[model samples]
Target chain A: MSPHLLTLAEAAALIAARKLSPVELLEDCLARIAAVQPRLDAFIRMNVAEAEEAAREAEAEITRHGPRSPLHGIPVGLKDIIDLKGHPTTCHSKQRLDHMAEADAAVVARLRAAGAVFPGKLATHEFAIGGPAFDLPFPPARNPWNRAHHPGGSSSGSGAAVAARMVPAALGTDTGGSVRHPASHCGIVGLKPTYELVPRAGVFPLAFSLDHVGPLTRTVRDAALMLNVMADGGQDYTRGLTDGLRGLRIGYVRHFHEKDQPASAEMAAALDEAARLLAAEGAIVMDVTLPSLDEFSAVNRTILAAESSVVHEEWLKTRPQDYAAVTRRRLLPGLFLPAVDYMHAARRRTQLLARVNEVFADVDLLLTASSMDEAALIDDEPEVERTYPRQARTPFNVTGQPAITLMSGLSSKGLPLSLQLAAPAHAEALLLRAAHGYERAAPWKDYAPPC
Target chain B: MTDEEIAALVKAAGLEDTAARYPADVRAALAQLARHKGQLPRSSDPTLEPTPAYVAPRP
Candidate 1:
């Protein structure tokens, strides 16, 4: 297989055995990015000079002493919201295109220490809120499966790049499913680790309390490998990955899609098939219910708006014209929201966490819909608006649980169909084990987009 | 909410000079929040405190 086609783990194993060169892998990825970038528009900036330097250093160091980690010579893209020292963290907005990151974000620092190469900064929604917007400084990333469709955001470019094989993995921050949305839409593995499991210090703040940083990769084990390095103490995220789900109790929340939000016919069918596949692996799949998706959406949105508006208040008052129309509408409400409402949202968040905990007590993981439908036309404003919030992701963000979205199957159109698996806080090991098992059993295992 | 109410809130935030639809958007937002308010179970007991949002890392 081509170096660009290798998963992180595959590439790492080859590099360790001296069969692959770090420089060779980085060059292959760079070449793929060159070929598909114009069509996909997945990157906002390319850190070529720094990345080439890092790759060469990794190559020489590995030759001398051996690899530092699985990512020792791997090229990983950083979402533009993340601070990478000496690079401008544009957040894909015209407003702060000149804002250079003085220091690496905590996660970036950790990744750098692990010998990962910085491929560049990927596109994000404007300040991680406004999206696929023509009015922004850069054109939004298009879906790899079907270029005309949305790639999902606010982590748009991260998902697009990984799915298109431009990079093995990329980092994305999720406030309300930004990571998982693109993961679902792009047919990749996206994990939002338990809130605060990974550091968020230097990433641009969308909603501080709700914010999370995670990886989008081609495989579940790849997600775990990235997490193992991103978090401190070197916790082994891959330890349980190959352990088949013989007796794992997975609660399939059908109501989230079937009743609360009503996912598309194809998505609904794909979800059922995914549950059946899990059961076929000797797992017990039981129907479970939680607070309505609407309740979670409302609570999550209210808090996100209130907090994000505060982050951008000065900009709104001074340079509101710089923001896209969708971004403005999304941020405007928070400006005048009664302070008491934010408090209520926070209070309800506590109760919601408890509710999910109660469910987790009986089941090892919870399965639900990530997006009600796959990528709609990127240019269809009304359709985008309609499908944007028809998701089960915000509930977990509100509950601060670890959730992973992986491709369940392919739609008739060949676009990726997705399902979400979530666990109680800090149960990412369980999430990966189940997701990895299903990925191996499912028909779409390691399926590449026809970009 | 009435236009007047929306206007007062906008003017209070000093965003009255923004687009004409700004006030209307605020009204719709407030209405949405009102709908969400109905979902939150009211706690009469002062002891049901909200989380500080972050807790120390677990061992």
Candidate 2:
């Protein structure tokens, strides 16, 4: 396999063994970006000169003193919403097109300290909400699996780049399923760790309370490795990778997608098969119920709209035209929401979180669908509008628990189908271990995008 | 809310351009927000607090 196609784990091992030079890996990535980026539109800007310089330095440093961390000398991309010192954190919006950061976001600083090389800033939705929009400053990222389809957003470029092998891994922010939505559609692994596990200091905020920063990568192990760096020395997220699911209790939330918001036939079947595989692996999988998907969605939207409106109130009031129509429409409701309503949502959020926590009393982890259907056509606004909110990922955001999305199967049309697993807050180690166990027993992680 | 009421709110928020461009979306989103607000519990335990569980780490 080409260096560009190597998983982060593979590359890291090779680099540690002195078999792969960081410079060689970077060149391969740049070549892939040059060859496929026009079709994928995955990056907002390429930091070639700096990346090349950093790669050479990494190669020299590794040769001199060995690896600094598992991520040492590995090239990774940053979603445009994340701040890299002296780079524009555009949030994929014209409104902040000229905005540059004087310092790295907390996650970027950690990744840099871990010796990861940065190739560029990846594309995102306009402020991570109003896209796959043509009206934005940059064209939306197209799915690597099928270029005509939407690579889910607003972490559009992060998903596309990792899935297409333009980069092995990238950082993506999730407020309401932004990371996992792309992971589901693009057939990659995306994890939204427990809220506040990864600091959001320099990343542009979507919803202050719900925002999470996470990794989009090809393998669950890679997600765990990236989390180790992003979480800045929390318990090693990869600690229990080989721990089988035998005797593990998994709560299967079948009705959330099957009834509250029914998934496509293919998605429903894929989730069922995934559940069966876990049970066959000796996991005690059983049906568990929480609040309805509608209730969670309503609460998520209320909180998101209210918080994001505060972030963009100045821009919305002064330069509303600079935003895409979708973003404008999505954000305007917050301005109209009464303060008491925002407070009510906050209060209800507390109760809803307690309800979800009640489920963990019986199970170690929760399983559900990520996106309810396949990726829609890039231009199909009606389908995008209908399908975008039909996800199980946002409920965890409301509960502030750790959640992960990984490929579970492929649609009949060849698009990816995904399953989500969530755990109690601060239980990311257990959550990732169970996901790793599933990835080992199931065959979904082995398939890659046609790109 | 009626069209005029929604329109007046839109104008008041300085989103006349957004109102003109996506009048229905604006209206629907507002209505949805109102519906969600209505679902909030009217009475709650006095001990319940709205603060999130996260505590910021020391710098």
Candidate 3:
């Protein structure tokens, strides 16, 4: 039955029906991770014993108490940047390797309370921004779709692990498309819940302003399920929304891809097909214009660089050499940012935010190519700064909104091209519903990489 | 901002202890970026509202 590869939603249903046991599920996932870790290097550490023990308890809980939630017995991976009590939240940096958290980050606590079993922490770009470089103590995670291709970063390992089916879902932080970029490259569903809808406490910050924690899953429903639990109590819940896209307003930022970045042939075709399917399902597809793309990326960079510098200032000063060249060079500018250019960027963000909000007045959601382009070969090296120039993710980051990426089509080389959905702040439920409807109509749920 | 200037900033920032040992070319590039920093407009109003803050507070 390929128990190891079941999506979170499928596995949860089977467990609920007593057709599968958490123990059996956990073992299958552990075995898969064992088989893949050497080639993929997705995990920083594994607590097989702890995971097994938890599974046993979960098995008993199902017998004695029934399921606690969709993830009640589900095994979930966490990016190394999030704090899990008693484990080293290393953020993939040696300087912080020994730093242990005394309590789970708020999201971790919520996941645990909801009955998720933790197998271990996964790898990440050093401190979430310095990666696809080799000088770190741990190797960067390889993409599951093709080991030789990049998995994208800062949430590199989480994307690799989830796409590999080594774990059904994982928690990843998105600051400037960290989650969606990797999901697009690895061919999975990555959801960045509306900014601050999931609390950031105890999670290491890259850019306090841009950093957001969300789920990467094999299915939109799984992401929706995970979002329900991960969302803060004060935040809105979109789980009850199953309206199926009728009469929904969907804005296609086709210009973002068609006229601006020029998506690959496969990507363009996929966008057209996705739009057609959604229109057939009753979504009003309209063309919407965004603010200047260059200005958006530049402002996003300025804010992220400046803020991330503040977060890493201590390490940058104490063990600056410990950082990879990319991180060091990228972060160096923040130190000299004069604090006012940073302010100017912040003020500009206001104007841009208003424009985005105004666009939403005519539409419920915005769509664009998840990435400016498709996946690149693992061995390919571009100039460090040019690696992600003009990412489709900066606008969401700049606006502090929720965004998601779904596999829309396959590239010429057979890699996946993704469609991105961005919803107004705290409107993840609507975004997920729209994504769920598209996913159903064009269901590219889980096409495993021929690893 | 030459390699010398970057070195000076590192030393001034107290990261002289940790900044990577830059080769002539990399140092030159960083120095160029640092100099470009000088070309950025300096805001007379430095106390503007903080960011990720002005984005309508994420609703």
Q: For candidate 3, what is the TM-score?
A: 0.93
Best candidate, DockQ: 1
The candidate, 2 or 3, that scores higher on TM-score is 2
Best by TM-score: 1
- Candidate 3 colliding pairs: A321-B18
Model 1: per-residue lDDT, tens digit, A299-367?
Answer: 788789889987988887777788887787788778877787787778877777778778988999998
Q: Between which residue pairs do clashes occur in model 1?
A: none
Q: What is the C-alpha lDDT of each candidate?
A: 0.89, 0.89, 0.81
lDDT of 3 by residue, A133-242 (tens): 77787898998877887888889899999999899999999888899888988889999877778899999988888889989998888898898789866333445456
Q: Is candidate 1 or candidate 3 better by DockQ?
A: 1
lDDT (C-alpha) at residue A146 in model 3: 78
Q: In model 3, how large is the Cα lDDT of residue A394?
A: 78
Residue A112 in candidate 3, Cα distance off native in Å: 0.5
Q: How do these models rank on TM-score, best leading?
A: 1, 2, 3
DockQ of each: 0.44, 0.40, 0.36
Candidate 1 chain A: minimum summed lDDT over ten consecutive residues — where?
A336-345
In CAPRI terms, where does candidate 3 land? acceptable
